[model samples]
Target chain A: MMMEKLTVYADRMSQPSRAVLLFCRLNAIDFEEIKVDISKRQHLSSEFREVNPLQKVPAIVHGNFNLSESHAIIVYLNSAFPGIAEHWRAKINSAMDWHHSNLRQGTVSYVINTVLGPATGRPLNPNAAAEAEKVLISSLSNLEDIWLNGDGRFLLGGSQPSIADLSMVCELMQLEVLDEKDRSRILSPYKKVLQWIEDTRAATNPHFEEVHNILYRAKKKFEQQRSRVAETGTEPSNKIGGHSKM
Target chain B: MMMEKLTVYADRMSQPSRAVLLFCRLNAIDFEEIKVDISKRQHLSSEFREVNPLQKVPAIVHGNFNLSESHAIIVYLNSAFPGIAEHWRAKINSAMDWHHSNLRQGTVSYVINTVLGPATGRPLNPNAAAEAEKVLISSLSNLEDIWLNGDGRFLLGGSQPSIADLSMVCELMQLEVLDEKDRSRILSPYKKVLQWIEDTRAATNPHFEEVHNILYRAKKKFEQQRSRVAETGTEPSNKIGGHSKM
Candidate 1:
């Protein structure tokens, strides 16, 4: 059977988008990556809306069948494609579902409210950031104590990294944009989780680092902006200012 | 090979729990319903923690393998058992994932903050309730305009109801506990959504009603409480009052 070519619509800066992209590259799945520049508000355009009515990255067009939501897309890809292992599906599904309201929700809320909001013209929301930090800390503890209880490096004790690992590590990567001290304070306690993140990166490298370049670049720019504020003895502007666009 | 009996830990009051129970009953999958009453805080008990360390309702023990997250549980059940249609898997997976951040998040927040918070001794937050309403309305619009755009009933236009339909409709049913005028005002705008909800309920039949009886009973109690407040010219107590426990 001739399979329809897979085209992924993603913004590399978005965590789930990076997961999908990294998954495809790691599996050697033949695909096209159509960059959906979320930082530029391109995802909300009508053109992209035709692909995903939710107006979110990353969505996928597998021939005529269009699918959105990262977990769903990856699960479908795993089932539809060759070479990926099947044994990981159920546990992977559990981890991904838990991710939404737990890690993904907290990390996304924390990053956007505390930092990225300014880049996008949404002002800092200290109350929301604080609440998100609490949720993130609790979720990290759960990840370490519950999910990573086993000796294996990857989630659910899989020797090979699963889609769940990719998705979750991508979420944690959002913390990179935080102030170094703040990021350390939040993540330093989760020793096992940090080890698992490194393990996942090692397992799916090159592509993992490749997809995350956007985030790393943004992180550097954010740090530079913060240091400038410190040197100038001025509060950072509500916006990212004219120069440093994410 | 003989399969181990499935045991589901659920509270009927929870939207996702009802979805899981209704799915099992509709599919005639042999299972034991072990009620983990959230209102009574049984889900938080150390015993329940053995079933699901996350301490959330709607966990399942299928033989030795325990799974939490209703979407994962239902999808695993659909696969591990017979009688479920296979074609619905990808679309159903997409809908369930989309539900987490959109419909499920918004509806749960709106209900908890606006109504159910007090039942559990958590005071209502008018700000959160108002914010949740905005999200709920936007989600409903997306449901009407995007998901239910097809001629056939249910999400993604399947003739038979999918897990997605059951989960989403169960979430909407939370509104039943709100004041009648508020419920109508919130729901009436999306004519197609209301019809789709009915279609889902009809497709699931006697089981839907059987499981939703808990919600229906709670609805009646909330209404009576409201009427008493109106007649006596007293602000409805922040609590649901001692006599009416959900």
Candidate 2:
């Protein structure tokens, strides 16, 4: 039986979506990319709901099978495709599962509360930001002290990068939107985490950088907005401009 | 090479731990059970940290390999053990990944805020509980409308219960500690969700009840405590008694 072409519905601004996109490109898997602009609430539209009832981006359609959750999507692709079976292992699976509630939760919460919330016209929630920062610091500490403790540069000490590395590095990439001081203050304590992120990016290389271009654009736009606020000499409104087109 | 015996580190009071325990029992996988009582703060012990540096329950030791995260443990067990490969599938993987931020988060947050907080001498946060309730209601609606919409009794419409079913059902079981009024009010609108829970429970009976015996005991104790509070004419402390021994 011939396999149907795979379709990925994602938004690069969304971390997990970028992971899936980068993974496909890295593995040389042929697929179509359908951008779902979450900032515009496109993910909530009725049509997207048909693809994922949960109405989230980074969902996939292979033939009649539809699946959501980036970890699941990557795992399925690895299983369904060829030449990538070596990357899927028990340790990697453990790392991916740990990512959801730990690293992923912290980075997403911190970035959303501090940066994305105001950018989207939601008020900056100081209390929430403080709470999220604690989780972020603790999660980073775990990455430095535990996960990267092994001799291997990647998580669980594997010499080669795996799906876990891709997914997590994508998550940490959200910090790019933070101003230099805030980002450095939060990330500086974890030498290992910093090196691991660099190592993951180096491993994935061109595809990793290519998929993250959207975030880099957003980061640039965010910095420009901050400077404009500074120049106006008024009380900083804290809100940045809305999402840029991908 | 001879295979070494597996040791499961868990505490039944924890939802994911029970899921791991039930999966092992259901699959008839020979293993040793090592309880890590979270209520007593045993999971925070230095020794437990050696087993899982993240210091969470539902971890496993398979020979020299130590794995945490219930989803990972269940997946690993299914792959490593005999007679269980049929149960592992992409859809099930999707459901498990989705559970972390959806059903599992809502249930765990709501329970901790309203029931577990005061019981553990932590002050109640009505704001958090209210927020958690909204997420809980939304999650229940999703489970009913999307997951259980299919003809099959379990999630994603599978006839035989998968690890996703065990994990989610165990998470939902936390609501048993709530008073009847609150539990009914929260769960009533989702008819399909209610039925799915029953179907999952029935499909995994005997062992299900046996594993959940600790929760049943906790429920009875909670009810007795509520009656005492009512007789005393005190404002409902909103805290149930501390975790009962397994």
Candidate 3:
């Protein structure tokens, strides 16, 4: 089959977007990346609204199918491109579906709502943040259980990397950036999960220079905010205290 | 084929659980309903945790497959019971997948975070509410566009209702109950959506009565809180909101 041109609407820092990017790379699906400027609120702009009114990242324009939602996009990719590895595709689908309701909304939302709120100087709603953290801890604990009990090194039964591994690793990476304590909590108990992340990274092509470029830009922004706080003689807003008892 | 017994862990007021009930009623999938007491937080109990450690409702245990997440459960139902209108199944699957990450999360979260919060005298986070409303409005607008422009009366092209209609109707109903003004907004422009709800109700069996019971129960709880606020100057401590917005 002739390769169709795929345009992925994404920001590299977004876990969902990373999931799609990694999926495309693994499947060897020829695609072009269109960075949606989430910082400038371009996603909500009229021009981009024409593309996705929902204004969320991880959208795709493939031929006649203009799809949003990372899970839908990945599913469409797997169904449309049949020549890719079957086991990997199935595993990715299962994990992506699981992540949508469980980890993404559950854990990732926790980090963004709680830790990232103070980081960005957004008014942190303590009640919502606490609820989010409760959900996040449960989700992370579940991930540990699944990783410990599951038959494969990755989430599903496969030796090669899948979209599941990609989606999960990105979310965990976000969690790591949010709180160093959380990184320890997630990794220390889940030995297989830690190993799996390393394995998946090694198995895939590390040519995410473009991905790193986006991350570097975000880091620069973070540093600027820190400097502003320092100059103002204000306590750093983003820092979280030690982990609380479950 | 002999029908597989399905056990649904649900509460009637929950939008997602209602979606499951609607699916079973439409597809003639026989299942026993196990209502979780949201008022008492029965979902958080350790026994229930084994079924879904996340402690959310609209989970299912069918044969050997134990699944959580409303979208996952609905998809599994469609897949397991192919007798439930195949064309409608595909359309419903696509629509549900789209809505899961978009409309469902956005609308449901907005309702809970904004309307329900103020009604319960909980500390209302206006920023979260505003952010939620932006997403909710866009989702509702897209829903209007799709229903108006799409190929069929229902979400997918079929005379009978599918899981998409079930999932959507439940979410819309939650939005409807949140506030009279918001309800008017939805009812005014979305005639087709209103029609879809009636059609879904009329086509399906009496299972919706159970759904109505749960909704009204929630409504009663909200009213009681209002009355209590009127009588005494203090707010209720254990105010249970609607669904998780998963």
Candidate 4:
């Protein structure tokens, strides 16, 4: 029962891309990983436009059918492969709705401004990052109160991880780059959510770490830059010039 | 085979709220509609927060179950009800994903900036509106190039309208307040999408018009304000001053 090899256009640094990549690997859904380096602006090139004219990455091309948006791609994959055993369909649907403006907004944009900005020459806008942090804290609160209510290890209170869990946790992990005080100040309040992050990583195993390697690297670079600024009072600019490294 | 009565929290003027209202009515899903007027800041009240802590309109509470986000609410209803003939589930899923950033971002944000701002004392920012229009036009172009490529009358090429049609067309209709020239310039080229808008309206008929009645009224007011401003060169400040009407 071999599935057709699906072609996934992704950049590991992208949060949703990691979600899609991890989903495929975890589900044993065979896919050819096409590295679309967003840092190189590869996603915006004309060739990538053929796959996703939206010019965003984490898209998929299955035969002639092209799909973009990590959520839709995951939904398509869930149905395309029979019996993935995600029993919390109702809760999963709710979580997706919650994810877009909540988790997706809080982590993704915050990281782009605070963590990824310096690397891309858009020096971190602290005001924007602060607003994003507020959003993330509120989002985590919502997650704790609603999605992760039960004692289950996942958002859906299921024994197994659902698409919602994968999509959300992937974005949340990007907070790793922030100074410990800032990250923990927002995240530490949500004990259950933190535990679930660990649980999700555990359940997804090697693939989770595989997809998130780029984020981990970025986090290290960000911390190093932060400490350098702290020590020498020197500008953190010019450390990672050019978009190719993003 | 009567189902438990559903309770929907919505505001007529909110685009997604209209989508949810239209969805329920179109599907003949009987529900009690609870008015949560954003203009009055009713949604932000502690009481309303009990229902949806986000305090955004268009949440539903069915029995003990609560849900938020118009897209997810509709998707859940589609599954909950038996034999609802809105086929093209796959295409519908794709459209929802596409609708969020593309249609929702462009149309909804433009309407918010251009149309709603003045009524609330925020005044129109032409630059922002122009930027939003470009986004809307680009979004429409993408729709024409991709979703409307087939011979289908509706988005999924189905005879019956799906939630995607309902949600997207509702958002698109918010463009009515734009200057006729501006609106036409952006929308006129896309004959297929225009026809689909017509098709969705026809399919969702009475309910569509019923739900969008507030929008049409708002459009009328906008036009009157523009004409009055043109004639008298007076400030368009005194029209509707308070939250009760919004």
Candidate models: Cα lDDT each = 0.87, 0.86, 0.68, 0.80
DockQ of each: 0.72, 0.75, 0.21, 0.44
* Docking quality level of the chain pair in candidate 2: medium
Q: Any idea how many clashes model 4 has?
A: 1
TM-score of 4: 0.86
Cα deviation of B159, candidate 3, in Å: 5.9
**How high is the lDDT of residue B67 in model 4?**
84
- On TM-score, the stronger of 2 and 3 is 2
- How well is each residue in B1-246 modelled by candidate 1, as lDDT tens digits? 127989999998999899999989988888999999877779889999998988998999998989988988988898899767764777778888889988888898898897788655678788888888998999999999988987788788787788888889999998998878889999999999999988888888899899999888998887777788779965455453345444
TM-scores, each model vs. reference: 0.94, 0.94, 0.76, 0.86
Per-residue alpha-carbon lDDT of candidate 2 for residues B42-107, written as tens digits (9 for 90 to 100): 999999998998999989998988999898888888878866747658888888888898888789
- Evaluated at residue B141, the lDDT of candidate 4 is 88
For model 1, the superposed segments whose C-alpha errors exceed 4 Å read A1-3, A233-246, B1-3, B233-246
Summarize candidate 3's per-residue lDDT along A1-246 as a digit string, tens digits: 246677899987787888788888777789999988765566887877767655778788877557776766776687788787755532244456667656667666666675566665565566776776666666667776763356766675576656677777777666644444555764577666677767766776564443445655655655566578779966564444424343
**TM-score result, candidate 3:** 0.76
lDDT of 4 by residue, A33-55 (tens): 99999778899899998898778
- Going through the candidates in order, the fraction of native interface contacts each one reproduces equals 0.68, 0.77, 0.15, 0.36
Ranking by DockQ: 2, 1, 4, 3
For candidate 4, lDDT tens digit of each residue in B1-246? 246668999999888998988878877888999999888889999999999877888999888888888888888888787767757565577678777766786786687787677767776777767767887888898788877776678775666776787888888888777777777888899998899989898877887788888877877877888899899997666535534443
